[model samples]
Target: MSTTPLPLSALAAPIERGTAAYRRANFALFLAGCSTFSLLYCVQPLLPEFARDFGLAPAVSSLALSLTTAALALAIFIAGALSQQVSRRRLMFASMALAAACNLLAAIAPDWTSLLLARTIEGAMLGGVPAVAMAYLAEEMDPRHLSGAMGLYVAGTAFGGMMGRVGMGVLVEIGSWRSAMAAIGAFGLIAAIGFAALLPPSRRFAPRRGFVARHHLDAWRAHLAHPGLLRLFAIGFVLTSVFVALFNYVGFRLAGAPYDLGPAGISLIFLAYVFGMFSSPFGGRLADRFGGRAPLIGGIAIMTAGAVVTLAAWLPLIVLGICLITIGFFVAHSVASAWVGRLARADKGHASSLYLLFYYFGSSVTGVIGGWAWQHGGWSGEVALTASLALAGIVLAIRIEDPRQPDRSDA
Candidate 1:
């Protein structure tokens, strides 16, 4: 494939369903989502490995991911603004490339502190991906088919998240966590190059060309002031908080108590994300027909039930619970993220950024809170925390006004 970007004339018009541009754009984003999320989350299954090797406390070990998410949350806010002045495709590609290199550095780090630093930087690098990606889909894809296109992107993330955890588990089993990290990093670098070549240059996005502090601050203020957007932002926050919190501590439960599973065994558990991979696109299709309200609430309801089901002592029930969580989370996410594009009248990048700002902030915060819940209250306590947040997500989703213009995020 030629490295030269697609000319503006090629993609100036909105990408319609079944068109070559639509297929190319979606596939490129699929790669982008796969690389970005796999790099971000590959360490999730490695939490145990960190504890065993570093002789750290459970909460302390979680800082590997929590700190990265924390940095990512803040960086997302900055990157949203930065995207205004840069090429969305180039920014995303660079972010992916640098982040992959950072992981390689992390793979060789000699101490816990060094690893944490590398991960944090990796998080910062990833900030460019999500918000920009959402903006890109919202801009380039035909408005009539936004739901389906966004669904494909979310499905990519689902697959990436799955492989990140699942692949890390398998890799660490065959070699070591260090080698696993290096391998995923190398894959991300390749994906970055591919993404840079495949993603059509922006036609809808009018670059601002400089740091217009006043404009950015105003955009943030406007998004914050919009009641509907705030509801979606809250929904984004609750979604990740509950999801990350549960997955964060579940490893300890599987490692100890009733089930004593090794990295490979526990990794098989993350195969649940396959459910997520399917649910996301289905959810998007649902949104296109029904509207955002039904699916958003429905997804959250499923998540709440899944959290409760995990309380069961049976092994099958626990795996079923994880699958339900994965399904519900992706559905809710696909709906909510697409809805963000619908509701934004302008400055789409800023709007997407604000939404993800809340999304990742929740992930970072809950990782620690979930740790405390696990340490003090065990799996039941973790369930209590997730279930409550999920319930709140339902309430917020209910309050959000589904925009009729662009379409619903309802599947």
Candidate 2:
């Protein structure tokens, strides 16, 4: 019941894993992850509907998600740097409020252009959350508890991803995609309030107020120059690209031909994210019990095998394959992200931002490229592309060494 604090030189102590304070911190972050992902991804299942309503190609329809992620990728770098000058909690709160408001604007936008503009701005606002969340956890959580805490946050993402996709699908069937967006925006508003209320003050982080760009640049350069961190960043990129590409186009594949699944049916596929939710924490525990190296390799191998299984035409096999892919991706992501936090001895915010910058970049580029592949070579082509990327991830992950020491509690 009592919190344990571990000292780290000049820095304040970290919140340990199994305590009331730690539980509350994790709960608040869980809601933050839930709101963030739910708002960002609610439109995924509606891509086919966007195509029908907007009179667009499959590749263009994917712009709905790709554009948002693209903007998010760019904005995170600036937000990460800004966290050094501003209160990190305030930055995240403002981001959640602004993004939820933009989602409302997007829900009511009368035209496709207007909708895209709203979503783009929303993506920029969302940039404040993900990178900052990782950095915050790394700074405030005890190193012994860091992996599981990160896993819990990632699980929240899985829950949100599943809810957002599945919720929109069901809502669209009941009403329209517009109504679905409105509902998700309303949910985000409530979530933001809960996050603001429940999250505790930062114990380990102190705001550094200055307009020095050189300090920020130097931090980024340090992370980039680290061989292990560089490889992890590459792995993040490939992993996300492969995952996003699959989900972006899989709707088109199942909606036509033998599967002929409707919007609600396609939504069912996102239930695979439940498997992801479980795998994240499970993978974190495995890494803690064993080591990051074997779990990382195993996850990538599972992803590769899952991609191959999905090549089959059978619907049952396809669903099973999707489950495998979902579990594998989340496990790998949870491990890789935790490693990034541990590897960075300083400027963890910058390190987290760099990792996510590449991650979302993969989502932006590969999502669109996968669409093109779907347009030309169909599902088979997309599969080949993603499988190759997953393979590349395996090789990159293999090159990363386990950390020589546990994370230090310093900013």
Candidate 3:
């Protein structure tokens, strides 16, 4: 066996911490992460407003966000394939700009149908961000800095998701929902501009000259063939299904109950996301100290307990439940997402895309179905659905053969 080491000149030098380029890259990704999520979910807290204004059922009103996520789930595959040919910064910049424009269009949408159409388009446009961002990081960042960068990026998404719902509620309370949408749309546009200006062009990425269907398909096939990857994908599906479904209906429940809440007051509940932001890093630590499985299952248990807590008639208990759910969701997602990267020795981009496909698919499908549960059976029905999904997540985590095999890459 040859004992000779390769020269540094032969390797691609990676972006490391404490550099101008590193700072710009992380901040750019933070903006991209924040803008994509905030715009995608800004409609969440306003489902009641849509129902009242449009004379639609809760299930129908939820299509504003649900349709967008569904379209995003489908478009992720296409975006993953497209990344081969497009420059990372340009593709992400275009996506951010287009999505912001679509959000503005939704703001001025004349009717429910028009709003849904605009939102779906916005979702499809956002396809360029999440998975692509992950792939870009894997390609550009030094391995030592990758974990820290990933955590910060995920934190941005958490912060944005919280602000989007809370800000929507506060804005709608001050003005109309349309004006609120416009304000958020403008925020997204600003973020896009900042992202494009700040992000360094990819130094390590090689742009494929043309698309190759067979090569990409084979990569995806290999990821799906792995048992651990499949389980993580299922966990992604359940984690989001339980979290988004419950949040989707909580606004409806609060809007019409013994404790009626206006948009602003209800938005305060979303501040629970602050707890989620903290929990994500903490979850990674726990996974490091004890392998991924313990924390993964424990997080789901927290979620299950949280779901059951909401069954109480007291408003404080319901809010507490929501907070627990948020914390658990981030914890589980942090572990599971990091695990996906470790599991895929090759085609990491395709693995990221497949995982997110299930993740947002859950958001789109169960987000609306939870509304059905809310309409037919009320809060208890929603709890029932979420609890079942949490249980499924537990079972999936149990079946994973070796969660401890994951490396230092913790999201």
What digit string (tens of lDDT, one per residue) describes model 2 on residues 1-411?
211122356566788767777888888888888888998898878888888998989768877777787788888998988887777788888898899999999999988999999999998999999999888888888876777788888998899888888878778889999989999998888888888887777887767756578888999999999999999999999889888888878878899998899767887888999998889878876776666777888888888888889899999998888989999998999888888998998778899999999998788788779989899989889889999999998888888988544333321
| Candidate that would win on TM-score | 2
TM-score versus the correct structure, for each prediction: 0.91, 0.91, 0.85
lDDT of 1: 0.87
Candidate 3 error regions (>4 Å): 1-11, 16-22, 46-61, 110-114, 142-147, 255-257, 285-291, 368-381, 401-411
RMSD of each: 4.4, 4.7, 4.6
Model 3 per-residue lDDT tens digits across residues 88-124: 8999999999999999999999999999999999999
C-alpha lDDT of all candidate models, in order: 0.87, 0.85, 0.83
Better of 1 and 3 by lDDT: 1
lDDT tens per residue, model 1, 61-172: 8788877877888888999888878899999999999999999999999999999999999999999999999999988877667877888899999889888888888898
The true-versus-predicted C-alpha distance at residue 12 of model 2, in Å, is: 2.8
Window of ten residues with lowest summed lDDT in model 1: 1-10
Ten residues in sequence with the least summed lDDT for candidate 2: 1-10
Worst 10 residues of 3 by lDDT: 1-10
